[model samples]
Target: MKLVVQVKLLPTPVQAAALAMTLRACNAAAEYTSRVAYERNVKSRNELQKLCYREIKERFGLSAQPAVRVVKKVVDAYTALHSGIRAGTLGGERSRRRVKAESKPIAFRASAAQPFDDRCLSWRHDASTVSIWTVAGRLKDIRFAGSADQLATLRAHRRGESDLLFRDGMWFLIATCEVPEPEVFEPTDWIGVDRGIVNLATTSDVDNFQGRRLRRHRRWHARKRAELQAKQTKSANRLLKKRARKEARHATCVNHRIANDIVAVAQRTGRGIALEELRGIRDRVRLHRHQRATQSSWPFHQLERHIAYKARRVGVPVLLVDARYTSQTCPRCKHTARSNRPTRDTFSCRRCGLAGPADVVAAVNIRDRARRAWALVNVPVSMAA
Candidate 1:
């Protein structure tokens, strides 16, 4: 399994400058590669394109760490759409919603093209430390924030390393670690989660596992965003950039905390988690001033992805089931009857007079649906009846 561990690097002033250059180059390379790959897909086979990219990289000094990853994604998207058309997973033109719209401005960082040691298979650690390449040999003090084993794993990605630079004052040596998949088992505790606008998330099964909403704080950001849109001055733009970075960092930290807390609760309680398979939420969200405040405000999908991976580390499995009727259906009466969830905060059941906080009910039902889907999938049952 591809396990990622981000290690912090504190480089000297010179090293930081070099790193910034590398990051900018990497981002540029990634953008170029993406366009080239998309165009190449029409004229050549995948195998040929790989060889072409390798040759291009060797010819041009564009070896940013993120280039390969980004191009791979672009190629995959292109291929998937084409293949889907041929196989009929979708018909006609690709959906506008499926296209990846970058929430933040597109800029390449030098550390974007960090290479991995292992190919398709093999223990990544034994491949040797290939992630770091020092020019003007023997650099500054950079420490690993993990165990020896973790460091060994990080080396798996950097079989042969390159230096990168960014525009900002920073440098990075991208590294990767391969974590062997742990033996996964069915869990006894079945947990349900409800991800929403009012509150970020709430669990049906875990009493204490509730995710707080970012709406109030996010509203504070909305006003800042408004002032930002009015002026085109460089200073104003720079302030907007600063504010955006701060808000993004804040959102990420909140996601990390919420995800870790959810998994920790599951691990302690010996339960499995179930979350809705939300699709097109970005487009489906109502077009309003508040929703328009930030396109990336909804972090439900990101949090779920994090939770699934982290949960796997400790053998806590997660199930993504159909979200249809999960909110409106009555959990207690098993009623499929529709009811209007007029407000975000309230939850009232029409069939059963089951009145409680709306989030709580939805959370429990989400858990219930998870158990059902798990059974249908024929995966080992994780929930205890």
Candidate 2:
């Protein structure tokens, strides 16, 4: 598993400026490498490296590792472009023409890549300090701080490349750490989880995680953003950006808690989690303007992702069940119809006397679907219930 830990650097003014200069120099070399690759039609990292390696060193006065990093960066950009063109996301004809006509190098801002094998980057856990190469030679013993959990994880499992990111007058070191994968479980039963805008999640066992508070918070943010947008001032723009970050952080915290609770329930019950395959749900269903905005703002995807990773991390399997008619289908009588759902929160079947919370019914259906699907694929009856 890949986990990222972001640590705030507490660098002196001199160290900060040196770091900034290093990042700028890295970007300069990258920009130059990109231009050279495009002009020479360099298609691979090896080709770009061979063509521009020596020139980059001479032009940017960078050591070998930084030059290689920037050259690899440009190669990766071209690789992404090629993949986009192949996938038909970027118009092949237009992309080809643009590539041929491209003259200016791409600009980078407030970011630098640090490869792990390079000698320029080192960390000292005891002092909470880092040593990094800069344009002004090397800056050593730059203090950094983060949460206790993050610091522990860094000390324990930090691996591979990291990025130096500058934002809002602060420098941060973003490191990726490796985590041990959870054991694969052969679940005896499946737990259904229904996700919605109103309630974050409802389980087949009648447990619910309400989203009303989050909805209100989102609406409040929307209004605040609109108010600031109307002012059209520089300070308003800054506030808007700050509010966005705050909202994201709040949502992420809520998602983490909800996911942990859901996974805990599943783990306690020795059941796998079944969820709706909500891909293209917005486009599949039509909604009014306000409803559309609310639905768009709903963090269903984020919640799903959190649940998935958390489940996997705890040896709980997660399945994506077919979402069609899960809400409208009657769990009691197997009756399915649009009329069965009389309200957003209430589900009642016209053919039968079945009635309950719409989200709960959906969760039950999802759970059953996963059970049937898993039963069909697996040979062991012990694994399915």
Candidate 3:
């Protein structure tokens, strides 16, 4: 498994300025290289490197590693562009009518990150600092800190390329790390989890993680954003962006907590988790104008991703099953109809007289579906015996 652990950097005034300059020069080099590649119709990385490698090195006054990184950044952009063209999304007869500009070159922002290889970056354990090669023609040591968990990963499992990121007047080093996957668990039983905007999650075991507080918070944020947007002032727009980041962070924290709780329940019961496959749900379902915003803001995908990862970390398997009629279908009598779900929260079966919370019924159905899926994939030991 690949994960990025962010470490906070504490750099002196001189070192910070040097780091900023390094990023500026590196991004400028990347932009120049990409523009040249696009104009010359350079497609492959080798072709791009052969064309602009020396030019960037001499023009930007950058060392070998940073110069190579700039070439790589531009090559990746061209690769992505080619991929989109092949996929019929860009620069083809199909897209020519839809998109007016086909020959536009890739552009990099001034604040784009500069990638670092192991040769250009090193960490000193004794001083809890990292030394990075900058545009100053020397390595600059910057103190860094992280949570104990993050520090442990850096000490044990850090791997691959790191990116130097500048955000909100702070510098951060994002290091990629590899973690060993947990052992696969044998199928003993399965638990269902229903996810919705009203109740963030509902389990077959009757546990509900309510989203009232979260909804209220999102509503408050929406109102504040609308007010700020209406003013159309520079400061208001800046505050709007800041609030967006803050809201996202807050929502992520809440999602982590909720996922932990759901995974804990599954682990305690010795059951694998079953969830409804909700991909493209937004495109499938239509809602009123006022309801669309609330529904769109639902972090269903984010919560599901968190739950799957947390479950995997603990050796608890998570399965996604078909969710077509899970909410309306009666789990008791197997009756299927739209009338069964008369209300958003209530499920009343017409044929079997079965009634319960709509989300819980869906959760039960999802659990059964997952059990059948597992049965097909693996024969139980008792049955084999």
Indicate which candidate wins on lDDT: 3
lDDT scores of the candidates, listed in order: 0.60, 0.85, 0.86
* Candidate 1, RMSD to the unseen true structure: 7.0
Per-model TM values vs. the true structure: 0.67, 0.88, 0.91
Q: What is the lDDT of candidate 3?
A: 0.86
lDDT of 2 at 156: 92
- Candidate 3, residues 130-191, lDDT tens digits: the string is 98998896655689999988888787788988899998899999999888788968757999
Point to the candidate with the largest TM-score: 3
- Candidate 1 ranges with C-alpha deviation above 4 Å: 17-168, 206-213, 281-296, 336-343, 379-385
List RMSD in Å for every model shown. Answer: 7.0, 3.5, 2.9
* lDDT, candidate 2, 215-256, per-residue tens: 789889999999999999999999999999989889899988
Q: Alpha-carbon error at 132 in model 1, in Å?
A: 4.4
lDDT of 2: 0.85
* Candidate closer to the true structure by lDDT (higher is better), 1 or 3: 3
